[model samples]
Target: MKELIPLRLSILGHPQRLAVFRLLMRRYPDQVPAGEISDALKVKSSTLSSYLSALLQANLVTKTREGTSLRYQVNMETTRETLDSLYLDCCRGRPDLCTSYQQPVAPKERHMTDRKYNVLFLCTGNSARSIFAEAILKSKGQDRFEVYSAGTQPQSSLNPIALEMLKAKGHDTSALRSKHMTEFIGEGAPDFDFVFTVCDQAANEECPTWEGQPISAHWGMPDPVKATGTHAEKSLAFHQAYGVLQHRLQGFAALPFDQLDRISLQNAVDEIAKTSD
Candidate 1:
């Protein structure tokens, strides 16, 4: 409905609710338990209850019972109502702004940051892809970036194949362990400059709010652990994923961040996954 835009935006205007909406959006087409949402957003049960109620009342998200708990999901059908409204509004009002968004920088140009950037990679399990990304950036951008990785529903251990890959590449894996995403929030968490979700199962992943709003993107890929082939095939999957993430990270590292504005920098960060395998 045409009325949904304001209602939806208004409902999402609350910071906690907006975070909840984004967490749900990342997990679109699937339902997440209210408990899970609370854990992911670091919200108290009471605050999350109100956020969910507002989202549900605005029809921005829908929920169903999951045993004793409630599971919520993005109302895709309702989502489209807002999308259609925005599309038509842009077409009718600011048609020039509706055109394809173009990146403002030259592809190969390298830029420098005056200070080290804090970056985080997230995945459902901090085993393979995200671990590799953290390792890769820490290794390559040693002076330029501080890197970390975590999972939404963390696995109890790291993936063996991933460990082998990093070892062969001579990266120190001693500091690596599968960790919960919440460990980075609250207390003395480092403020992040960029956050990327490197898992295909994004719905199971949580997008937390950083102290400062960090640039984020879904650099999603299939989990090598879930690969159903021989050991070699699984390793190859891990290798392929590493290459893609490595390339994307290199591209990110090369961007002249000090020169680009926030919008351009975000576009650059988001373009990496698309441009790299």
Candidate 2:
């Protein structure tokens, strides 16, 4: 039997260091020198050195002395042990809770409890990115998810470019109309199971925000509606936004909703952002 390397998230407490651990895991089985990890994560050498040192101390990662360079690799042995310990500690009764979510169930067979998740997508304008997301999820999740989209400052009409592309993808647009976020509020409104902001929050642009989403994250994408150029260039912007949303939605759709706790659910939603194209 293989011995377990002690795993402690407290040692890699900061988001930056935890990010470094994830980065190394993404490139697992291939050792990454400190310089490469620093460049990829945009952290300074001094700063990255500190993060790496903590990870090493926690035994969450392994280091190789390859001549003058110190290459780093995720300690898979430690990761496996830590996850096993976590499951033992938390999944005493729920076997499905700790099982991997990679194997997605078919729409008809999934969510056997007859639960239909209420999902909301938001942006400053209802026209483009949010619209793209609603259509994508409706198509991908089929009848399993009740998907809706709205804007902080609702537009009187949907973006024509976005509509054109949706039609190109063979998505029906008759039911999708631009609307304000308030419509979902007031009495007798469905409580959203998932809320996502699809606008470019990273640029500090004005995007919608909501409280108590249960599970929420910013799946931010550039506002293709703001793009100015030739028709083809503008179309390209919307196309890229569609690709990013489609990829992220695929991740969201595969999650085992019945098998996750609030902490696990929140982590899964946040991790889906990494799949951004």
Candidate 3:
């Protein structure tokens, strides 16, 4: 007769189950819907539900009733224990491999006593990509970063498509305007930490070196305004550019600025710029 192990111990022994558990760990406390998990992992919903049920039975996940939808979140206490057990098993009694278990660190506080770094976005016309990036980053980055945008040769106005997209995305576009970069070059200009040129021409043009010697980067995105197609096609291009900028900026805000030297930080920013292309 085979010996029976405790349920918690038995669940930990299964590698397939552990993978699902780790997926939840990555999105912890977010209460993912089962359908999203199925879509993200390319698993059939029926099969995924069985796995989720097993996890629930093992107390590794908790399900909450959200109207007609069921939401699943990681049971943190159980998750910590499982991680502790795995760490011990993997280390093989090596103290160097497994340090004392500590509570996971929270995201760093955004409060900076030092003057906030000013970030400037530049392009030729500043009607589309540059405008979208400036608005999105300013709205989403909040207290973590200060942001601005200007054009080498200012446009008559902000792009209507860009303004509509921003409004659709729940961002306030009321205060946004198109302005010339020259306005920012004088003695009273706010010193910038980063100056990102969002178009190839503007990036190539010689400009005054910004005060504070801001780290410069080129994020060359194709101009959505140049799309020669149906209205839907032009709008789609703006949406795509917005998504690319949002993803890169979110990653930028999460960077460990304090821990990295100037060169390393520039490299990291450059790597993020590639994702937009």
Per model, state how many residue pairs clash.
Answer: 2, 0, 0
Which predicted model would earn the best TM-score?
1
Tens-place lDDT digits, model 3, residues 159-239: 898899899989888878998998899888877878888775575455676765566677767788888789899999999
Question: Could you tell which candidate, 1 or 2, scores higher by lDDT?
Answer: 1
- Best lDDT among the predictions, by candidate number: 1
- lDDT (CA) for every model shown? 0.78, 0.75, 0.73
The residue-level lDDT of candidate 2 at 49 comes to: 96
175: Cα error in model 2, Å: 0.9
Query: Per-residue lDDT for 108-216 in model 2, tens only?
Result: 2244556788899888778989999999999998767999998877789999999999999999999999988888875676677787777533212323333333456
Residue pairs with clashing backbones, model 3: none
For model 1, the stretches where C-alpha displacement exceeds 4 angstroms are: 1-112, 203-206
The TM-score values for the models, in the order shown, are: 0.64, 0.58, 0.58
Least accurate stretch of 10 residues (summed lDDT) in model 3? 102-111
- Model 3, 168: alpha-carbon shift in Å? 0.4
